[model samples]
Target: MSAYDVARHFADSWGLVFLFGVFLFAVGRALRPSARDEYEHARTVVLRDEEPGK
Candidate 1:
């Protein structure tokens, strides 16, 4: 087999597994309880008031 064939096989198999693992980790982190405050702050940061003049 050639380099192209080897690369294609890895991409078609292990690449998918790596991407799925990353997706699961991201989803888990987002849903975890400790992240609730961070998410809430992000959701309302735009509505918060700030002092004028630097």
Candidate 2:
């Protein structure tokens, strides 16, 4: 095989791997629950009841 053909093959193989990685990352992010959800669910507690002006 010519040098050009060899280089092209390598590039194509690596490119497919890179694309696969990106696709997996996108899918994982879509399926995962975010931290914002947890914070929103946490119960709020007031440590100090003092007046705001004081």
Best by TM-score: 1
Assess the local accuracy of residue 3 in candidate 1 as a C-alpha lDDT between 0 and 100: 100
Stretches of candidate 1 exceeding 4 Å from the true structure: 52-54
TM-score of 1: 0.84
**By lDDT, who's the top model here?**
1
- Model 2 per-residue lDDT tens digits across residues 1-54: 999999999989898998999999988866677855654545342455668877
Q: Write the per-residue lDDT of candidate 1 for residues 1-54, one digit (tens) a residue.
A: 999999999999899999999999999999999999999999998897887663
Which regions of candidate 2 deviate over 4 angstroms? Answer: 1-7, 35-54
Error of 1 at 33 (Å): 0.4
Q: Model 1: clashing residue pairs?
A: none
